[model samples]
Every structure is written in C-alpha cells, then in structure tokens.
Target: MVTLNLVIPCFNEQEVLPETTRRLLTLLDGLVANGAVDASSGIMYVDDGSHDCTWALIEAFHSRDPRVHGIKLSRNHGHQNALLAGLLSVEGDVLISLDADLQDDLAAIPRMMAEFRNGAEIVFGVRHRRDSDSFFKRVSARSYYRLLRRFGVNVLQDHADFRLMSRRVIEELRGFREVNLFLRGIVPLLGFRTAIVKYDRHARFAGESKYPLVKMIMLASDGVASFSTKPLQWSAYVGGVLALASLSFGIWALSIRLLTDRTVPGWASTVIPMYFLGGLQLLFLGVIGGYIAKIYAETKQRPRFIIERTL
Candidate 1:
C-alpha cells in the first residue's frame, strides 16, 4: 500500500480552512475508496502561527478524523519555512503540498500521483493560464521566470509551491542547508526525473494575498542570490567595463594634448567620470554586501522556526 501525505502550511486562513478541509477530505476518501492510496493516507496541516481560529479548526478536524494531524509553530515564520517544517515532520511514500486557500485544484492530485507513479520523482502542478490575475501580476510573473533563467536559477516557469514529491526526492532536498532557501530554484537542482501537469489557477476565495509586491521582490532577490553566483560575476564585469572606459578617456585626452598642442581643461568631463566611477564603486560594494549578509546569517546557525504547540 502506498502512503500519501498532504501537507498544508496555513497562516490566518480561518475563512477558507473549513471549505478547504472538507474538499481535501473528500478527495482523500475517494482515493482510498478507489484503492489509489492506502487507508492510512492522511493530511497534515501546519499552523504557521495564525492568530485566528485556524488552529482550533484543525484541532477539531483531527479529533473527528484520525487521518488528520497538525503542527503549530511558535511564531509566524514565513510560508517557505513553514512548509519546510511540515515536510520534515511527515513520513510518506509520496508528499503533496497545497495552499489552504484552495486556489490550486484538488482534482489534479490523482493525475499528479499517476505521473509520480510513471517514474517522475517530482510532479509540478503548473498554471496553464492565470486569467484571474491582474495585468501587472501577469507581466511581473513572466519577467520573474525569464530573469531567473538568465541568471542560471533553474525554476519551473509557471509553477508555485503546489507539487508532488517522492520520498527519495525529499531525502535529497534535505541536503540543501542554505539559510535562504528558494525552493523553486533549489528543487530543480536536485536533478530528478520531473513532470509537469498544466491546470488553470483560480482566484483566492477569501483574504488578500499574503505576498505583496515588496514580498515578491524580496523572494526574487533571494532566489537569484541563493542559486547563482552570476550576480557577483556581473558586478565584476561591470567594474571592468567602467575601468576600460576611464582608461579610454584618459588616452583620448592625452592624445589631443600631444597632437593639437593644447591643454584641455574642462570641469564637466572630469567631474562626470569621477561621479560615474564613484557610483559604480558603491554599486559593487552593495552587491558584495548582499552576499556578506547571507553568509553572516548562515554563520549564526539559528533555528528556522519554533513550534509552540501541536494539535
């Protein structure tokens, strides 16, 4: 019998939890009845320090169904860390992650499992189209994936956290110990047999998206920095280009002075190069500082998140 575990990391999702759980239970029941998964298959909900009745609801569900289990974090760790904590806790032959808001289609799970059985270690539930998103969001998402690929960050173009992972793939993912974990980038680096299932994404049922524009930018920056050293290399290339430009200017000034027999004195030309070089220096320093900050964070060896209680 194949044991399948569904891990949901929820933050203040009281409005959507009841419906999400009910739908998920129905899916699990169907899978068991059809013998696609063992009767012991279960759902594990990780409460990421929700202030609402999210934990209370999960506890109620657990009491009613022995197949339901949960973990409560001590504080509000971000979504990625919360998911990681849940993944670390569960033991299953195959693990699936879905949002508590139910934007991702539950109907796609069985198909994802079929792909997993077809020798795919990781199955991605990719969005075929995001018609529900605004124009700005659609453009930004496309740009994000393009930029990540250019910088050598391997990532699924239209995939979020919704996916299926075989237990062996999970074991490989455990080796990545970086403090800034961009799972979308890191997962592709595992080099496992992977497949994608296209599905139309739905709008959020309730509550605004937790990922605002600022948070999305931060995630993009983290993804670029964590997966590739191309940014640092680009900084070095830009510095070299600036140096060459300055040298060319110096040569031109000297040649004009020698050939035309005139001392060319101009504040505009000299001051412009000085300002440009100064700004370039600062930019390079900032790039180096970002990497230094990441190193400092890792050196501290702090726990990702604390678990206050479990129900």
Candidate 2:
C-alpha cells in the first residue's frame, strides 16, 4: 500500500470542518482497511487565514489524531494558492486535493486512488451531475466551460480541484511558478497518464458558500485570462471590424453631404456612433487591462502563499 496525503483548503469553514473531518477520517480508515492505502495515510487541512475559530478547530483535530495535520497560512491567499501550498508542502507517495465544504464527494477519493495505483499520473474527479446546483449556477457553469473551450483552453468541464496527483506529477507542478494561480487550467497542460472518476456533486453541508457571485465571476475571469490570449485577439478583431465600418460610414456621409441634399440634422447618427464605439473601445481596453494586470502580478515574483505554522 502506498502513502496518501489528502489536502483540503479551508477558508471560514468552521461550521463544516467537523463534519468534513469526520467523513474524511472515516473514508481514510476504510481505504486503509481495504489495503488500498497505507496506514500512514493522513489528512492535511490548510487554513486560508480564517477570521473565526477555524485554525483553533484544526489545531484541536491535530492534537486529537496524529493522522490529522494542519497548515495555517499567514493570510488569505485565496483557494488555489492555499491548495497549492498544501500540495507543495507534504510528504506522501500520492497527493489528493479536496474542498473543505463537503460538496466535493469524499467517496470518489478511493476510486481516484485506485486509478492512481493503476499507473495513472493524475486522476481527475469529474462531476457526473450538477443536480444540487441552482438553475442559474448550472447555466453559468455550462457556459463557462463552453467559453473556455471556445478560447482553445483545455480544461475538464466538471472538474474542480478534486484530483489525485502522483509524486512525480506534483514534482513537475512545482516547476510552474506563475503567480496568477489557476490549477484547473494548469493541470491539464501537464500531459501524462491520466484517468477520470465521475461522481455526483453535493450541496454545501453548512455555512454560506465561500465563493459567492462576485468571487465566482472573478474566478472565471482569472481562469480565462491565465489560460488563453483569445480574448485579446478577439478584441483586436472587433476593433478592426469597427474601424472598417467607421470608414465606410464616413464615406457614405460625405457622399450624402456633397452629392445630394439628403442629410439628417439630429444627434442620432453622431451620438449613437460615439456611444457605441466608445463603449466598444472601453470594453477592449478592459480585456487588455486584465491580461496586463496578470502579467504585472507574475512579474513581481511574489510568494503565492505564506505559511504561518504547521502541525
């Protein structure tokens, strides 16, 4: 049996940590008993600078069970960075990442391990169904995946961070030192022997979702900006098209004023084009600005996350 380290990223998840811990411990015990993983297999929870008693609870868990370990970050570096911190700072034959919210089904862990043992470098936990999500969420998520594909970015549609990575795969991942962390897009780029285990997603067990509407939008934007430059290309294409249209319109207006007496004396044509083209230019600038911001962040070479303490 090989050693497995389960990493979970937590942020203000005090309400759900106890239940999440209980379920994970039970699942780990079963895997060990079945000889799927060694007894040394343990769960590591990374506290993403929670404001409440999350770190305190994690410390208690660690004291209660040697199998339960914790890593406290110096500040809230977001979920991806915290997950990266746990993955990079652990000792095990294989590493698995999951969410602290219990929505990522724990039952899939064993299957992922099975695939890993079968010589797969990475085993992705893909969601079979999103019945638990709201209508808007389902629609938006579907659209997001489709948009990524349209942008020529390779990413598993229903997969988040629930995945198992072999030691070598994790080692390769460490070589990627980008500050704009987007693991979902980054993992697929690491080509290797891979497998997928499908499972149904569940609703949050407790507390409000850490990723509300604003955060979800920001994450989607980051995913796109980090992976593909298609947005920039498309914006340029749009500008070219609008420029040609503006030139044609100018020629037509000149013809009407010089060759004929058919000209409208109103702000409809002038103000309309001004607002429309102005809005398009601003939109293009925003897209370009987003990429520039990511470049700026990466160029700084700042630490993705800082560890406050560990147990």
Identify the candidate with maximal TM-score: 2
Model 2, 59-150: lDDT tens per residue?
A: 99999999999999999999999999999999999999989888888888888988887889999999998888889999999999999999
What TM-score would candidate 1 get against the native?
A: 0.95
- Clash list (residue pairs), candidate 2: none
Per-prediction TM-score? 0.95, 0.98
lDDT of 1: 0.89
Worst 10 residues of 1 by lDDT: 302-311
Candidate 1, residues 101-165: lDDT per residue as tens digits?
88998888999989987899999999989788899999999999999999988899999999999
Off by over 4 Å in 1: 258-266
Model 1, residue 150: what's the lDDT? 98
Give candidate 1's error at residue 273 in angstroms: 2.3
